[model samples]
Target: MKHSGSLLIVDDNPDILIAARLLLKQHYQSVKTTDNPFDIAGIINEQRKLEQPIDVILLDMNFTQDSISGKEGFYWLKKIIEQDANIVVLLMTAYGDIQLAVDAIKAGASDFIAKPWQNEQLLGAVTAAFSHAKDKQQVGKLTRQKQGLNQALNTPNFEFLGQSNAMQQVFSTIEKAAQTDANILITGESGTGKELTAHAIHQASMRHSQTFMSLDMGAVAQNLFESELFGHKKGAFTDAKADHIGKFELAQGGSLFLDELGNLPLEHQAKLLAALQNRQITPVGSSKAVDIDIRLICATNDNLDQAVSEGRFRQDLLYRINTVEIRLPALRERSDGIPLLANYYLKHFAQKYKRSLTISDDDMSALCQYAWPGNVRELAHAIERAVILTEGDKLDISSVVGNSASVSTDEKTQSTEVLNNVAQYDTFDLDILEQRTVRAALKHHQGNVSHAAKALGLTRGAMYRRLEKYGL
Candidate 1:
């Protein structure tokens, strides 16, 4: 297959230009020759306009103006690099001196090729130069992408704040662990702010200035596991139209946060273990190994110890990732922090919605008492929802959490009675049974969608769809 890289040969000798172009054109898609060295810039700009920027250039080291010393080649090379450092240049001269070759490389030329070069030698040099140029382009692209992501991530002030003793312990651990490069394992229930904790650690670490890439292990499909985390070459698979950089490569010299890590399949866990153990990854369909240097941080809601006992999670992999385990407490377990978190979100959403709103002491007390099944995330959603729905200046506790969130024993009994009545209406019809079951779950959980979804063995999204379908 012909390479996509465009090639240009610039020489005062027409015979040399013709000979080189003829040989390169067979291997490359676009090969152009120019006798005038001054036309290099215009040709490069024209190719870029055509959306096929010049990738490699072969320039004679000795032009008519400065034939012996190769001074003209250095000038043109400097000019070419200044135009775009990504464009690979191979300096060519009949009088090839070893020191001149070293100087050519130091001045940004990709390689030095002697004139009257063998066909094989010339082809090899151009191929290597093209590869180097492509690598440089990939690096440049990743740098820009990382910069944009960092900007977006840094927009919000680090809000991983809490005053509870449990959270204080977590913060202390983070402070100690962030100084080192040990892999960190964060385990907690859903909505417990595992990703936030990971980000906090990344921000506090020595790699704070570098990229912090977060990958959702559960969201990645089983078939795409290797390609997604380790990367893939162009034509690696049916849909792989171009060489793709994976999370491991993108997070190089930074931190990699693997969220929902317990959901990784047992088979894929082995591959992850290998990469973590070796500190390198081989992109899919490519034999070359790319070394990686990243601070590994993984979060999961699943009980990995139990998983290991059941042979669902590999023990060796767990040992590799869990060098420093930081277990985040459930919101109910750290109720002291609820007031701080609640007020923070309250003020935030109040400003966001342009409402002059305040939470009453009774509502704040109720928020602190409620057993938040979905943890801090649930609290945030509750505050945001209440801020949007409340009509009064003071936030309503009933609106913030469900009506039954901190109800008395009598109210709890009444809610149970309502759930019993909902179950009494069970019909054999699948739609009716499903709707009734959903309503009963919602009533039992005091209208907490996350808890109700869990009770019915449904995802939050699936539960929302059912709620919309039944208009409930």
Candidate 2:
């Protein structure tokens, strides 16, 4: 088969150079030969300057007189690689010096062939090496194109208010982490706006323009976790009808928010830890690994240290994700920011619903005083509901305070019951427990499926299915 790639042959022997050049010239488009190995650098440089660089190099391992150790071959290989590392360097050695040839390959040579090789064997190796170089070039081009597209697309913007000192500190840490490419772990109780903070960091960071993909780890099934995080090829599994780009691949050059991370089981944590540590992922049903470039931001309501002690979370994975840990203050703790958040939600909902609604001082006090087990999320729902239902200009405190207490009480009771069931029954129906947990989360977030899903460390799709299953 004829190859389009150019070739460079370097050897100390005139006969070997002439014979190899004559043999390879028929198979390749351009073949350059040099008997002095010292002149290989100049030859490669000239080729590079001409914009017709050699694609593959056939280098004799023992180029110096009385040099059977192949040190000269290794030195020239290093020089060639330094000039252009992408070029394939195939080493040639005497038939009796096969080990030396193999060692040269280990040092940097791409491949090795013995002297007096079959013409067909030489031709086949060069073709294969040329094919690999072309494939690498094509892949590099595609990666650049995809990265350009990802950076060009518009990403959603978010604004975070942090009037309270606790929140101000959170903002300060966020600014620090945003400047550097650090994997961040945001921790707090439910409804603390971990996801919002993640968006804030992404919007303010250097990768602000790239995609910000969010995945709820808890919502994904155990079997599909790999497919969801690292992607899967077509025919990877029974349901993998088409190729899929996992969150890690999709969030290239940007941020990936793995919400509810503590929900990942121990078995799955190993897979996640491996991908993160290696900075690469192999899609399901594919042996080839794809390199990933991402800034990770993860959120978890669970205390990871406690979970690690209990054997629910991996210690190594914990260390990997939390390069910089930022704890967001719960709503009750940030009293100063409550009014701002409340009014923001009120104004937003009022305009969205086309209503004239204003918060009363008494109502603001009620919002500030509430325990807010659901944090800002519960408060936002209270404000939005009041905006939708209240007819008068000034919204009263009764609706929010009254409904919140009842819902909070109900959630507590339901949680206590579930804990009791788990502690008492050896074979309790998991469906019933899941239903109760879903209901409590929904009630806690005031029937907002998305918020409730976050509170439950589940994906919205997963929460929706349960809502239907339990007929909530």
Candidate 3:
């Protein structure tokens, strides 16, 4: 037999209670009813103590009055929601009081039905209410599960560890945006924790129960990007022997995080734009367009406006994807955050490596002075390295100070060389100098494209073109 959950119906009329019991008995394992509104809470509490709590409440409006006004029921609804926000309460209102029903919904009712409701309509509404309640329960269960798993996996703590005014504004903005279903575009320098911000938004949203899937657009190969995103039919390509579901399909009713979104190819951008505009997608080799419900959160380190002006990115697509834009400050720009982030990473790595280490004032000063071109990611790695290299509880700053001194020497030498070379010419070309500086940084990083690109303050694609132009 199918397992039918319990339900409680509250109304003052004995005939109405009997009718509700009969109507709901076919679907629920137990249909408890009360003709006295005063005893409703006691009955619910007693049943809950018995470990068979009500799954749904069919609350009648205007229990004491014959008139159709829902004033009395509204107060009961508010009480129920305040007492147990998890309980699903469906209002029973007259046809003329639909506006009142909507008001009840805003006050926290799961749904409402009118008097003289048809059997099919009533059943449908109740079924929908049950489904929503179950979904919420499932999400709560999953959150607990994730928390346990994270504990076991020993993931790093993710509090927004920053005290800068810019960071404060960012936090405030995120708090305001978390209450709605707006698509957010996060722009920042590389390693500035854009993905972390996306995770925070998902954690704060109503749909946090659903899965969160992230894809790095820059990492995906151009030829495979479409198949990777939209899935593929059996025999869609040479490698596809079976059907594959895309990220969009997997993130249905959840979130799809597109990191480095500006790196998406122009052709793929058009397809993505269509999906965002229509909430539907077609697979690589399929003619059928599958409907999807997803909240898109995109991040990019590149200047999207410049890409749009260069005709490499679509302007309309940008507008559609960026309903809300959040800019994350670079670590160097938010200098005040350095000490906090450094200490956070220190404690984190110390626990991971089973060491107890402390930073001296000199070490702290050295960290705050350096320009972190690699942002938080680099800082985290540096702290991990230091933790491993140090022998005692106190970290030594000699290595860090020496590295800084070497970098300074290299910069001064390069500056003098640039001045000497430029002074030989009557006219200095800014573009040529910029290209040379980009080339030198690429060489210094030993062709590690991403690091060199960051050092030159250029996107990877832009860096690649400069590398080719200078034949480096």
Candidate with top lDDT is 1
| Model 1: ten consecutive residues of lowest lDDT | 149-158
Off by over 4 Å in 1: 1-140, 143-158, 404-472
Best by TM-score: 1
**What is candidate 3's TM-score against the reference?**
0.56
Better of 1 and 3 by lDDT: 1
Ten-residue region with minimum lDDT total, candidate 2: 149-158
Using TM-score, rank the candidates from best to worst.
1, 2, 3
Write model 2 residue lDDT over 1-472, tens digit each, in one string.
Answer: 6667779988878888888888888878789998887888788657654546678898887866776776777888888777666678888877436577567768877678887889888888888878877875567546644654463354432257769989889888988899989899999987788888989889879998888888878678889999988877655688875456788888898888898888888899999989998999988877788999999999998899999999999999999999999999877678778888888888877888998878766556557666676677667777777777787788754566664322354553454344334535443466787788888888888878888885554546556667878899
Native-to-model Cα distance after best TM-score fit, residue 26 in candidate 1, in Å: 17
Off by over 4 Å in 3: 1-159, 401-472
List model 3 lDDT by residue over 1-472, tens digit each.
3346668888877877787788778877878988777776777667654556567889988776665678888888887765555578898866446578679889888888887678788888888878877886667546644543342233225566679998999988888886788999999987788878888887788778876777778768888888877877644678874456677876778778898898788998998898889889887767778999888899998899999999999999999989999999988788788889989988988999999999876557667766666677667777877788788788654454444322454553453344335435543475587568876876799879898876544546556656777677
Query: How far is 347's C-alpha from truth in model 1 (Å)?
Result: 0.6
Model 1, residue pairs in steric clash: none
How do the residues 1-472 of candidate 1 rate in per-residue lDDT, one tens digit apiece? 8889889899999899889988888899999999999999999867765657789999998878646899999999999888777789999999998999999999989899987899999999999999999999888777755654563365333278799999999999999999999999999888788878999999899999988887777657789999878987655688875557788887889999888887788999999999999999998867788999999999988899999999999999999999999999999899999888988988888889999988766567667766776688777877887888888887865664456435764564465455335434645565787788889989999999988875554445456767988999
